[model samples]
Target: MRKLILAIAAALPSAAVAGGYIVPNTNPRDLSMAGSAMAAQDSAGAAYANPAALSKLEGLNVTGGVSLIDFRSTWTDSARIADGQAVTMIPKGAFPFVLFAGYGLKLANGMKLGVGGGVNIPGGGYSFWPGNWPGRYQIVTVDRKVYGMYLTSGLQIMPQVRVGGGLVYYRTTEHLIQGINFLGYDSSAELGTSGGAVSFDLSTEVQPLKTIPLTIGVDYKHQAVQHLSGHGHFDNPPPALQGYGVVDQPATHVLTYPNRLEVGASYQVIPQLLVTAQWTWERFHVYKSDVFNGGLGFSLAVNRDYKNGYTLRLGGEFQALPQLKVRGGILRDISPVRPETLDPTLPEANVWAGALGVGYEVMPGLQVDAAYFHAFYDTITAAGADQAFPGTYDTRANIWSLAVSWKTDLLQRRK
Candidate 1:
């Protein structure tokens, strides 16, 4: 576990999004314009995106790939709370590698069974200027990190139906630091949580509607939480704020990933063209507590109007050439946390992303996958921004990632 933690930690140089909130949650490889698996045979990434898809593996296949992601963010005084604003710079890039081995066994009734495991960074980070950012974002280095992982299995119930499940683990830590010259504030807060749980998914391919090949999948992960314990201090909190004291909360979040529902379908638009789209939803708003909600020290309120967010991904792939595959996709996700709840420590908003990528099978199991994503920037004005420095801040981040794959065949039992 420690080694796994170290590997994952070393992988996320930029996986940590600013304000400790991550947008563009899907693997960059899947970011093509309409984001479903264009290469269904490419089950290598299934453990992270759709475990049920593992049933598609005909034999034992092992895949190991690494992605190099570059990120850049620049902030200006879009709100002009400051007299002169500068571009706030943070660390950039991520080095995430994926390794998984899945095998499908032929059952008595022509069914198949498979399993795999994967480690991924779900995304989140902390950033702050020591002094009041004369630019967009202002004050104190409040940093936090969130990591995710999965160990999974799949079963093909029928020739076209499959179900998969995973034992998932999530770890998060919040660090609140009073940056240099951060207003008159000299105190900060800290919170962290780690736990393991289970999640399940079901998928089926049907020919019910003539030309449409329907693929429906559902995923569910309950909020059987990990308790969070931490302490907080504030030198200038209002009198109503100081009594309850150092806040200690459960390691939980308001946009707690709830039971998710997914439905998708694909159609053969032409002899060589395929189109696919998928919809996913979770009752994120059900999470009202602010990590402090379930802790022994404080009272937290679930958001009354917040709901689990939703995403719509659409894309298609065309065999532009025998060796060249062209793909494009568009994705939108309703961010769970409101801008109002966005702390300088955690900033996020609904997201809109367009992706373009291609995979070239250099030779059989050896492949090269490259993807580029353009995520529309969302504006955030946090209380922590101006309050900590009596100024204003706005932030935006851009991402680009490339990956390589080498899949090993295990069915032949090669020595």
Candidate 2:
């Protein structure tokens, strides 16, 4: 029983890392531009991407969107224990949604202010591997979900400068299953937990020169730590181990989401064309380890040793006609997961992605946007890592987005 408990505890840390991969911007308009719209304050998604941009809006602006994602990966175990066995893992399609509404008003004192609130999915995913696969001991299945709700306010302090801040609430849920080998008997362990946390973000936008037609935007998100508590259930244990401490029990864990910073600049070269370039940095180094506590009087800490990561994006939008627009962009994303700690549950790697999209104005004050994005992940081979699963990993993903947006000043001016 003690050996079984130790083995299960040792494996839990790897499973805990499953859902940490960050999801891109959920707004289809922003997504179509390869998520490079931080300084392009023409849409309501600014509530989440860069709240300060909200001040640039004239009156009432709203956007609602959905993103459908397909994630695929494969792992090949080269270690002697597995004898070069390969397996494929595919998560069911994920559909994450977003909704944001913002209102800009002129106060009696001649000050401009914008207020907004909404919800979005920032990160989370699901993956399943065959129970009998060579790496089943590491993980079999992982399902995770994360949701973010925020209330933001932006102030146009000066004709050329705007600033904003917001309070955000994050909630997450996870369920994990992994195989356990005990005394020549095959068993399984499952852990399920849900938790919530609160954090904040700040943003600033500057139009350095009125003649330059250039805008620079910066946004920062604070880190958040969530405490999760749930039950750990052991199944199919041998009869001889029935009397041991292999029964179901409560469990607890802690997860620290990383702090993020993004800076971007957009320039309007002509009345019909606009281009943007953005850079994002995440403090993933804080994710050094994961600690798990089982109510049965034992605890385990596993090392992750993740490094900081970044992404570079460039995109452009063209006003083809009075009622039509076309967009395209490219991005390079550097992963935070180290080779020594890479696992199949979430086989994250450096990625290169491209996106194409279009927007149509159905009528006055109403528009629809759609986009398609594809990611090509670089292959990774890890060997001689102390805590890593030695293997070769390959992964890729596809995302499709659709959205609708509306804007109007009549509602706010009626008063």
* Top-lDDT candidate index: 2
Error of 1 at 199 (Å): 4.4
Candidate 1 lDDT over residue span 128-202, tens digit each: 543444422222454444456677777778766677767776655555444222245333333333434444444
Model 1 Cα displacement at 70 (Å)? 5.2
| Cα lDDT of model 2 by residue, 159-236, tens digit | 889999899888878778889888678899888878889999999999999889999999999988989888778887
Write out the backbone clash pairs for model 2. Answer: none
Off by over 4 Å in 1: 1-28, 38-41, 68-81, 84-87, 126-139, 180-214, 229-258, 291-306, 380-395, 408-415
The models' CA-based lDDT, in order, is: 0.52, 0.81
Each candidate's clash count: 19, 0
Say what the RMSD of model 2 is: 2.3
| Displacement of the residue 56 alpha carbon in candidate 2, Å | 1.9
Among these predictions, the greatest TM-score belongs to 2
Superposition error at 409 for model 1 (Å): 4.6
